[model samples]
Target: MKMNNVIFIMGVSGCGKTTIGKLLSEELSLPFFDADDFHSVANIKKMSEGKPLNDTDREGWLKIINKLAIDQSLKKGCVIACSALKEHYRFILSTKLETNAKWVYLSGSFEDVYNQISERKNHFMPSELLQSQFEILEVPANAIEVSITNSPLEIIKIIKKQYMKSEFGLFGLGVMGKSLTRNLANNGFKISMFNRHVAGVSENVAVNFKNEHDELSNTLAFDNIEAFVNSLQTPRKIMLMVNAGKVTDYVIEDLLPYLSEGDTLIDGGNSNYKKTKERSAYLKSKNIYFIGTGVSGGEEGALKGPSIMPGGSKETYESIAPFLNAIAAKDKNNLPCCTYIGPDGSGHFVKMVHNGIEYAEMQLLAEVYVILKELGNIPDEIADILESWKASASSYLLEITIDILRKKEGDDWLVNKIMDKAGNKGTGNWTTIATAELGVSSSLIASALFARYTSFYKEERVQLNKLYDKQTQTPKITVAEVFETYQFARIVNHYQGIKLIAEASKAFEWHINLSEMARIWTNGCIIRSTFMEELVEILKETDNILTNSVIVDQTKSLKPSANKVIAQCALAELPIVCMSESVNFFNGLTTADSSANIIQAQRDYFGSHTYQRLDDESGAFYHTEWINE
Candidate 1:
C-alpha cells in the first residue's frame, strides 16, 4: 500500500492542521504544504485583519490547493492543511485535485480549540477571530476525522495504518465510528477506524459528560482501512456520520472491499433517501446490507436515545435492530428508537416524509402568526396562544415552536429574530418529489412549502406585496367580530391542511396508520395536536366522516354561536380551501343537489342503464346509443 495521493488536515484554524500536516508529510517522506501558504496574500490579510472571506475570495485559494494536490499525485502522496469548510468548497477541491485525497478533519469542541488557541505561543490571529473560523468550518462528512485528544503521534499512526493497507482508500470515521467501536468491543466485535493518516480513529463526536454516560466518548478506532477491514467481525457494519455530499460517495467506494457478504453499511447522515434506497439495493445485490436510517434527537440523541428509522432487507433490520433500537429515542409508550417504517429506503424515506410534514405544519403555524400580526393587528403573544392550545393539542414540535416564538432573548422576541424567510432542509423538497411521483396532489402541503419560500423573497416581494395591496376589506365595527373572524381563519387553515393530508394518503397508498402517525406527532414528531386525536378518529372510521359534520352536529343545538361564527367567518375572508369542510356538513343535508328522481336519471345516463322502480329486481340498458345521437 502507498500513502494517499493527497491528504488534507482540515478544520477551523488553530486545530493543529498545519503542524500535523507537516509532521505527517515528513514521516511519509512526502512533500507537505500549508493550505494557508497557497492563499493569496490579500485573503490572509483580510482574515488576519478580522474580516470573514466570502465565497469569491476563497475560489482562487481553492484553485491553488487543487493544483498543488494534482501536482503531487504523480509522485509519493502529499499533505496539505486548509479550512475546506463548505460542501461546495470540498466538491471543487476533490474535482480539481488529481490526487486521491483522504481528508483528515481535525475535530474538537469550542472550549477545546478556544483554550488551545488562547494559549498559543505567538499567533497573529486573535482568539476573538477564532469564532469566525469555527463558524465557517463545515466539518467534512465521511472523512477520517482525527480527534485531537490523543497525542498527535497516535493520531498520525492511526491514519498511516489505514493508508498502508489500501493502495488508495477513503475511510469514513466520525460519530458512529468512535462509539460503535467501543460497543463492538463490548460485544466482542472487533472493528477498525481507518483514518488516512497513521493515527487512531477520531471521535468526531462532541461528548457531553453532562449526561453521565461515557458511551459518547467510546468509539472504534482503526489504524487504517486495512486494519479496519482485517479486524472486521463477521457481518461487519460500518455506520457513517459525515455530511451527505461527494465525500460520502468517496467513502462508500473506500469501504467496498473491506465489506464481505452480509456486511452492512449504514449511512447515518441526513442523506437523500432515494440515493440511499438505490445504494442499499446495489449493496444487497452484492450481498451487503445497506440501511438508510433517519437518526433524530441529535448528538446526545445518537449517544443515548434517538429515534432511528432503519430500512433495508427485513433480515438485515433484524440483525441490527436490537442494537439500533437500544440507542434510539423512546416515546411515551417507551417503544424503542428503532422503527421498521417500511422497506428499501423506507426508514430514511419515512423520515424525509416526516420532515416534510413538519415543514408544512410549521409553515402553517407561521401563516397563523402572520395573520395574527399583520392581519389582526394583534400583539405577538404566540406563547400564550400556544400554551392554551397545548391543553387541547398533542403536537410536541408545535408546542415547542410556540414556546420559541414566545421566548425573548434580551429585548428581542425570538420570533422577531427568526427572519420571515422560512428555510428548509431537502426533506420538504423530497416530500414534494415523492408526492408528485405518487400522483397525489398535496396542494395544501405544497402551498405551505411555497409559503416559506415566498417569505425569503422579502425584497422581491416589494413589488407584489399583497397584505395591503390586494384588498382593503375593512373590519366590522365590533371587536367581537374581529376576534371571531381571526379564530375562523385559524380553524379553516387547520382543517384544510389536515384534510389534504388524508386525501394525499389515500391517493398515494402510503397505508399510513393515521392513528399511530398522529400519536407519534403528539410528542416527538411534528403536527401533533390535541385536535389531531379527533381528526384521527374521523379518518379512522371511513372517508366520508367530515370534520364540519361533527362540529355542526355537536354544537348546533347548544351553541348557535358556533354556526354564526362560521357564517360570519365565511362572509369575512374567503379562504376557499377551508370551504370544503363546511360544504361537507351540508353536502347531502340540502335538497339542492340531491333529488331521488334526479339522481336516478344521472346514474342511468352516466352508466347507460335505466333505473327500475325500487320494488323491481333488475334494471334494463337504455340502448340509447343511436337514439341519443
Candidate 2:
C-alpha cells in the first residue's frame, strides 16, 4: 500500500519536536499537528504539577494524535509533533492508522533537553519532570535519529534523506535478498523482510536473517507477508528475490491483495525479459509500478554493494533512486554503479548479455591456462604471469583466477583436483538465443556454451582419451603472445555483448546510454575491469566505436599477436574455442567481400529465394534463372 507523506517528529519533552515539525510542515507544504494540543485537561494539569503521566493517562492522548495524523495524512499529508518515547507507543500510532508514517527522532543529551526546557516560558512540561521522561524513554530503533547538535534546517536535511523511511520491503530471505536488506539497512534506509516457509527447508530463513543482522537497527523481519507489506512506506517498494519463473509470479500474485495503487513490485531475480515485460504491463494495468531490476555481484557484492540496473517508469525510478544509489557500488569517481536502464525489460536484457560475456571470459581464461600448462609452465609460473597482467589489464575475474592458481591443498594444487565438468545457469544460452534473433554474430559466446556442454560428457571423453592416447606437444608461443591474444579476444567478446545491447535498444526503443552502461560496469560486476573504465571514456567521445581512431589503433596493434597465437594453437591440435571464434568473428566483421554472394546464388538456383546483385540497389530482390540460361 502507499505510505502517507506524513513526517512524525518525535522525542521526549524539550527536544524541539514541535519547532522542527512546524518548520518541516512548512517546507513540505503539509499540515502540522501537535500532540500536546489533544491532551486531556487532567493530563495537562498532572504534567504541569511536576507529575509524570502514567500509561493509562497517556493512552487517550496518543490515540487522538494518531487519528489526527492519519486523517490529515489522507487528505494532504502532515507533520506531527509527538513525544512517542516508547517503541510500543510508536507502533500503536503507526500501525493503528495503517498509514506509512515516517518517525523522525529529535534525539538529544539529557543535559541539552533539560537546559532547553529550563529556558522555556509557561510550558506545561516542567523541567522537574524531565528526569521521569528520560526514565520512561525507550529510544526507537526504527526511527530516523537526528542529533540535536545541528540547526533546524540541517536537521530537516538529514530527515529529508530519511523521508522515505520504511522505503524498501524485500520478500524472500535467500542469500541475495538477505544481503540486499542488510546493505540497505546499513545505508540508513529501513527495510522489512519476509520469506515463505517450507516444511523442512526454509522455515527459519527469515528468523535467522533477523537474528544474524540484529545489529542493523533499521531492519525488520516478518514471517507473514501481510505484516511485511503493512510495514512498508507507500508507494511501497517490494523486491522479490525468489526463483526466476513461476515462483516470482506466485509471489507477485500473493502480494497483489495487500498492495495498493502506486505500490511498486521489483523482480530482482534473473527472470526472462519476456516475462518481465509481460509482468510490467500486467502491473501497470492495475496502477502498480513494476520494475524488472538486475542486481549483480553475487552474495558478497550484495552485502557490500552491487551494480544495479533498474528498468521501469522514470517517475518510479526517481522515487526510489535515493535508496538504490545509497547501496550501490561506487566507481573511482565515487559515482554510484546504479542507473535507470530503460523501460520494461531492458535491465534484464542487459544483465543476460552480461552473463553471456562472463561465460565467454571464463572459458577464455580456462583455455589460456590449459595452453600455458601444456607449454610446461608450472602453477606458480602461471600465477605469476596472470598476476603481472593485473598491472596493465586489471579485472576482478583475473585477480581471482590468479588466486585460484596459487591455492594449494596439502601438496596438491586445488585446480588439478577439481572436476572438469562445468555447470550452466541458462543466462549464457539466453544470450546466444537473443543474439541469433537479432542476427548478431556472438560466436565466442556460443562456443563457450558448447564448451560447457562438451565438458559435461566427461566419462565418454575419459574413455576416448585412453583409446586415442594423445601426446602433450608444447606450442611454439611465448606467454606474451598468449596474453596479447587473450586481450584481443576479451575486447571482441565485450564488443559483441555491447553490440547486442545496442541492437536491442534500437529494436525495443530502450534508448540506453552505452557510456552510462560502461560506467556502471566499472565496479561490482563480474566483468568489471580497467578496460570498462577506458571504454566509458571512449563511448562518451564518440558513438561509432569501431571507427574510433583510438580503438582501431589498439585493435590493429594486437592483431598480429592474436593471429600467431591462434595459428600455433591450431597447429598443436589444442581446442581454443572462444579465441578461435573471436578471431573468425573479427575477420568476418571487417571483411569487404565474402563468399555469401555464391551462397545467395545457390539459394536462388535451388529454390526461388531471391538475391540482390552488386549492381542492384539494396533491398531490390532479383532471382536469376540459372537453369534456363
The models' CA-based lDDT, in order, is 0.58, 0.85
lDDT of 1 at 152: 84
Backbone collision count in every prediction?
33, 2
lDDT of 1 by residue, 1-629 (tens): 33245878888877888888888988888888887777788887887787888999999889888877777775676888878888678767766342356677778998888887887866556788788777777765435666777678987887676444322111344564344333333332223445545324433222222133343233344445656666544446567766676666787887787677756777777788678867877776788778787766444344445556676666676556545644555555676535665566666766666666566555545544543443344334555555555553446565666667767778877666765567776777777777687665444456666766776888777666564474424323233332333333334434443444455546544444545544443333344345554655665664433345774464343233334544543555523232223333343344474577666677776776665565555653342342444
> What TM-score does structure 1 among the candidates reach?
0.52
Best by TM-score: 2
The 10-residue segment with the lowest total lDDT in model 1: 202-211
**lDDT of candidate 2 over 188-305, digit per residue (tens):** 5668889987778778677777777665555777888888888776568888999999988888899999998878888889988889999999989999998888889999889899
Task: Output candidate 1 Cα RMSD.
Answer: 22.8
Identify the runs in model 2 with alpha carbons over 4 angstroms from their true place. Answer: 1-20, 23-165
Stretches of candidate 1 above 4 Å error?
Answer: 1-213, 221-232, 242-248, 270-273, 297-304, 374-380, 466-523, 527-629
